[model samples]
Target: MTNSTWLKSADNRVKLLIFAFTILLLPFVALSFFTFPTTDDYCHTLTVNDMGYWAYQKHYWLTWSGRYIGTLISATQPLTYGSYFGYKVAPAILLLIYVHAFITFAKALSANKLPTWQTALLAFLMLFVFIAEMPSVAGYIYWYTGYYYTVADISTLYLLAYFFRHYPAITAQNIIVLSLGLILLIGMNEYTLVWLVILCGSLFFFKSIIDKKLHFKFLVLSLVALVFGVLSVTAPGNAARAESGLYPTPLKYNLLFSLKSSFTWEFHNLSKMAPALCVLTLVLIPIACILYTSRKPGEFGFFFVHPAFSLLVFAIALYLSYFPSYWSIAEPPNLRGQCVINFWTLIGWTFNVFVIIFWLLEKERIRPILSLGVLSWVVAFYFFSLYLSNFNYRSAWSDLLTGRAARYNKEMIARTELVLSTKEQQVTVPKLKNMPYTILNVTPDWDPAWASVEVNNGCAEWYFKKKFFYK
Candidate 1:
């Protein structure tokens, strides 16, 4: 086939893939409609309402977290204004934004050589892998309070896209835009701060070496990001929050624990088949196709680094994702934190695979091995495996099929109605009979009697203006 004809065929195939993935994702979006607020959602809404927006931001900065941008977003959750519909649709909205950012990054990486439809398919695949294999879809996707991490992840993608699209010729405009993006990213979450600094620092170091001259604009950008990162890590709320945790370890112990725990988590993800399948089918295949079709191999100068060095850089990035949680709290990150780690893992793995492929393409013997038939088989197997074992998709479908999500929504609504209508100062409600596996329910329950008295009562009392307990 001619090159243009092949390109047309490939674009058509990518469009089909995007459509299929979108259909598969619809159930997860549907489940979001049944989502209800829980745990920190209530506390944050109450605090924001009582304290006002600016005061709540100050309170969070001083006592809870230094995540200024994150806290700022959390304080304005739909629940704070009693918009249940807004709460229900927030995840869908965030998911759409995430997809857009991913597509932008993917297009930039491809240098716009691929069609928009092709980049979109790449985004869909990445999203599917993330939702399916991430440790906590509920915490990261459905929970409104956890959205700071989501927004941070999205911002990172956009910043990286901008960097990729405009590197080697950094303009004043680029510096200003990057500076603003870095400030927002660093303030959203410490994980993104550490990840971005390491990534940009490494790139700046390598690019300077390659060009045999210092890039002054990037140097300024890096310094700006570093200053913001320091501000975030040193926030007074970090210390206060650490002190308030139930178990506080010494700094030395926390560092050691973080090293061990981070390595263990990284090793676990590396060994998983699902992620490997995703790397091969979603990431490697498209990259190989783009490289093979390109007229000049030298256009990808960035991928010319030694594969071992690239792997080491990616390893450090992945490890640091786990470090902040352990260093601060002396425990593994919560489910929300795992989402960031998983994202880093996927990105690192994909990049490493790309480096290897780029290196292999230089060898005449290996060029023939990357055939269309082999890629087709890989794609077929990926879909088959995803259908059989993708945990997120299966869990979401189970919640919908068994009516668990509906029942959970019904129970939460009934409880809210009781809290609002009751004249008594204290109220007792029944424990939730159905909890969807696809949603995280951290609210206190009767089974754990203390949780009912402690967490459930406090937040419910403040938010509903009535004491709440579970029977």
Candidate 2:
């Protein structure tokens, strides 16, 4: 075969692999949803299913839309197994929702100028937020409560992207639109809200000074958003929650401590994290190459010529995004919160990498060297993946991810049968073997023959609710 023909063939195969893997995503996620609830899952399920939603008793902004969204998922328990496909369809449905929403937003950002490959890479980046390969995949994207935040965040992103792209002068109609968008963004997470407020406001101020023109519309929007964020954070419910020691750490301490803890935690886990970093590096390197070749010279959007500013902004937002988690609690954030930080961290890391790449390309003297470096990166990434495939923990994590869905199918059946066939009103279920999908899982603590089955009936009762536990 000619060299060009051979290269084309390989490209086709790569595309095919991407397609098949994406197709595989649905069944994997669906299987997880089929399994029963884990630790906080049951509690959240009960609250959403049995109790009411949108109680001001819960934190107002934090829990408002999230409660409703989670309640929708919690309500799905009974039907999935008893009726239709149930939560088994969750992955695909969520994939389509998120992928479409993101791509649509991305198209708006690029003005539909980006190639399909780059767009697909963006979709893949979004997938990293979920998928078996990620840490706490089930918790962040599949659990009812976790999925609520995911949903809210997606909505927030969509709104922000749309509004930012279409930002205009203050007409009455535009004013309402801008105001509503700000409210929604602020409501998603106070930390993210604060981050954006500072990031966007600073950018606006700097741009105005540079351009010698004040943008009155964005200024008003920023002030209105500040008001919204303030009210949301200071809501009476926040004080009540803080009294429980949940929100005890003050904001000042949170910023300082979060910054300190992030470095400490990352440093401590450097060895353990190295392999995962390798995996991520491998995956991203090729995509970066593709991005470099496809986009024109200096076509980089925000990372244009001045990547230093972009890097600074990303670093600040990373700390701020992590601030709340570190601030309110002495301990580091649990897996759920960590997922958000990790996702942002990944974005920041990759963006910085691209910035370096851009810097190198901007220098005419190093084109040959840069091309050689790109080629080396791709080859090294392949070798790293090849090596990690056999490494103990990496292998285990991959195997666990692959085997989890099937395991869930088996356990759900056994648990269901055990609960259903009990002659007595109460019977304890055997403790379940742990699986990746079983985030925060706890099997019934019981003896082999006879254990107290306090939960024997609640399982059946909860079994009947509507359920789709994907973001």
Per-candidate TM vs. native? Answer: 0.89, 0.69
Error of 2 at 249 (Å): 10
Task: Summarize candidate 2's per-residue lDDT along 1-471 as a digit string, tens digits.
Answer: 584465356466458547744643544444444544443444444554444554422533343322223335444443423432434455446656766666665554444555565555455544533343345555665554456456555665576456535543236667578667666656655444666576657666765766689867667777776777776666664544445544445553556667788667654533444454455555555445545556665344444435666677776666566555555555565665565555555545655665655565655423422133446457546544544563322433553457754575577577657666766655555555535434332234432111112333343345433222111
Worst 10 residues of 1 by lDDT: 445-454
**Candidate 1 vs. truth: CA RMSD?**
3.6
Which portions of model 1 miss their true places by more than 4 Å? Answer: 1-15, 115-117, 248-252, 273-286, 292-298, 362-365, 368-370, 442-457
RMSD of each: 3.6, 6.9
lDDT of 1: 0.74
- Looking at model 1, residue 7 earns an lDDT score of 47
Worst 10 residues of 2 by lDDT: 446-455
**Candidate 1 C-alpha lDDT tens digits along 1-471:** 584465467667676766776777677788889998776677888888888999999998998788989898888778877788876898888877887888888887777876666667666766767777777788788888888888888888888788777764669998899989988988988778888788768777876887899978878777887888888888889888788745546752466778888788767766774444454554465455566558264565666677877888888887777777776676677777778877877777766666777776655435523345446657757666876677777888899889989998898898888877899988887887887877764444432211222344566566777766676
Name model 2 segments beyond 4 Å from true.
Answer: 1-6, 9-14, 17-27, 49-51, 54-86, 101-111, 125-133, 156-182, 245-259, 266-301, 350-404, 413-426, 434-471
| Candidate 1: residue 334 lDDT (0-100) | 76
Top candidate (lDDT): 1
